[model samples]
Structures are given as C-alpha cells and as structure tokens.
Target: MTSLTRAEIGALGEQLAVEHLRTLGLVVLDRNWRCRYGELDVIAADDATRTAVFVEVKTRTSDRFGGVQQAVTPDKVRRLRRLAGLWLAGQDKGWAAVRIDVIGVRIGRQRTPEITHLQAVV
Candidate 1:
C-alpha cells in the first residue's frame, strides 16, 4: 500500500466528512470555499433546522501534536465565524440559523479512520 501525503490525507478527510454529513441528511452547498481570509472546508444546509453549517475539517496522521480537534483554537474559531459571515453575506437565500462545526479526522496505519464531528463550535 502507498502512504498518503498531508494534502491527500486532508482531501480524503474532507470527503469522508461530506459523506458523513450527507448520511445525516444535510445537503452540501460548497467545499473548500475560500477568500482573502481563509478556506471553509465544507458548507452544508440542514433541512430539518433550516440552518446553514460552516464546517472546519482538521486531519491528522497521529496525535503527536494533539488530537485533530485541538488544532481548532480560539483564534481559528474566530476566523471560521468571520468566514461564515462572509459566506452568508454573499448568498441570496436567507437561512433561519447559521452555525459553525468542526470535523476531526484521524488516520492510523492498519486501522480504520476515526472521525469526530462537533457542532456549533463558535
């Protein structure tokens, strides 16, 4: 088997996160939406709540630095909130609610990948 590069692993993690969201009945709006600030890993609408969700995905090969979720610091949360507002401002449709989410993906050798989703991060 071949080892994956950091970018490749991150892409895979985002893909997996999208799949997980779809399974939860959320419709994906965009992926890797970027602007001058930064990138939004995933944007999805939750039909049940008529809410827009801005997702930040963090991927890790190991917990050497910390868990993937730990990467999303207070500063990162602030950035994501700003990006979410930017996204909403550019959209024509108004959402009843908007929130931020974080998806952490951990990949390990010879094991299935682990995924954790935290909603309303900010």
Candidate 2:
C-alpha cells in the first residue's frame, strides 16, 4: 500500500479539523480559501454571533520535534493576513469583528487526536 503524500495527509487533517469544528458549533462556510500570498484552510461562522473565522490548519504525524501548531511561523501568519485581506475585498461583508483562528492537529496511533485552537491569531 502506498503511504499518503504530504498534501494528502494535510487534506485529511484539514477534513478532521472541519468535522471537529462543526461538532463544536462552528458552521463551516468555506474550505481552502486562498489568495496570491497564502491560504486559509477553513472559514466558519457562528451565526448567532455573526462572526466569521479565518482558520489556518497545521497537521503533523508526530511531535518528534514540535507539535503542529509550532509550524505557524510569524511569516506564515503575515501571509495569511494578506490573503485574508484579499478575500475580504471580494465580500460585501464587514470584517471588523471577524476572527482568525489557527488549528493544530497532531496524529498518531493510540493517541486521541490532538487539537489546539488559537483564536484571534496574531
């Protein structure tokens, strides 16, 4: 059997994250939202609160070096911000109250899925 490629694995992780977020009451509005600078893995809404989320998903097979959240570098965050601006430009919606979140997912056998959510990413 062929092992999953990095992109494939990342996709799985993103899928899991979306499902998990849904379970927590976040309504997913978009996936793989992108622009010239970077991409946001997911965009979700809390309808009652009228808040939109720009999410960045990071996945890893292990924490041999560090967990998945460790991958979100300052540069990466900046790129996400840039892409988010471009994304918002196409919208009629206001983003002043929108939220940015980073989700870290680490996968391994026998370990419950590790998920960390960082809201208001900065």
Candidate 3:
C-alpha cells in the first residue's frame, strides 16, 4: 500500500469536514481563505442562529503524542481571533454572531477519518 502524502491527507480531512458541515445544513461560503497575515480554512453560515463560523482544520495521522485538538493552544486561539476579526472587518456587512471552530481529523490505515468538532475554539 502507498503511504498517503501530506497533501492527500489534508485534502481528505478537509473534504470530510466540509461534507459533515453540509450534512448539518450549514451553508458553506468559503474555503482556504488566506491573507498575508493568516488563513481561515472554512467559512459557513448557521442559518438557525444567523451566525457566521470560521473553521480551522487540524489533521493528525496518530495520537500517540497528542490529539489534533491539543495542538490548538491559547496562542493559536489568539491568532484565530485576530484573523477572524480581520476577515470580518474586510467584509461589506456584519452579522449578529461570529464563531471560531476547530475540526480535528485523524486518518489511519483501514479506517475512515475520525472527527471532533470544537465550537467556539477561540
């Protein structure tokens, strides 16, 4: 069997996350939106709450050291907060709510991607 390349793994994880969000009825607006300052993986709208969601996708092949969610530390949250704010500021209008989310993905041989949804990660 061929070991998965980093890009392939990332693509799989992102695809899964997007699919899951769509299944949950969120309207996907953007993917991999980046600027010179930072990156936002996925942007979606939760119509139920009339809110905007900015997602960060974290992928891991193994959890022996730490899980994917563990990688998001306080520093990461701070950066995400700043980036999200920057994104919001650049937009034409404002929403009632804004959220920062993290999607944890773990892929392994003979198994599908394991996912963890962390809402309001910042």
TM-score to native of every candidate shown: 0.95, 0.86, 0.91
Full-model lDDT, candidate 1: 0.89
In the range 3-120, model 3's lDDT, one tens digit per residue, is: 8898888888898999989998999988988898888889999988889999888878877758756878898888888888888888885688999989888888336778888898
Q: Pick the candidate with the highest lDDT.
A: 1
Task: Please report the candidate that would top TM-score against the real structure.
Answer: 1
Tens-digit per-residue lDDT, 38-104, candidate 2: 6779988877677878898888886775764677788888877778778778888764467778888
For candidate 2, list the clashing residue pairs, or say none.
none
lDDT by residue for model 1 over 39-107, one digit each (tens)?
999999998889999989888787787875688899999999899999999999989999898888888
Name the weakest run of 10 consecutive residues (lDDT summed) in model 3: 106-115
Off by over 4 Å in 3: none
Output the worst ten-in-a-row residue range by lDDT, candidate 1. Answer: 104-113
Question: Which structure is stronger by lDDT: 1 or 3?
Answer: 1
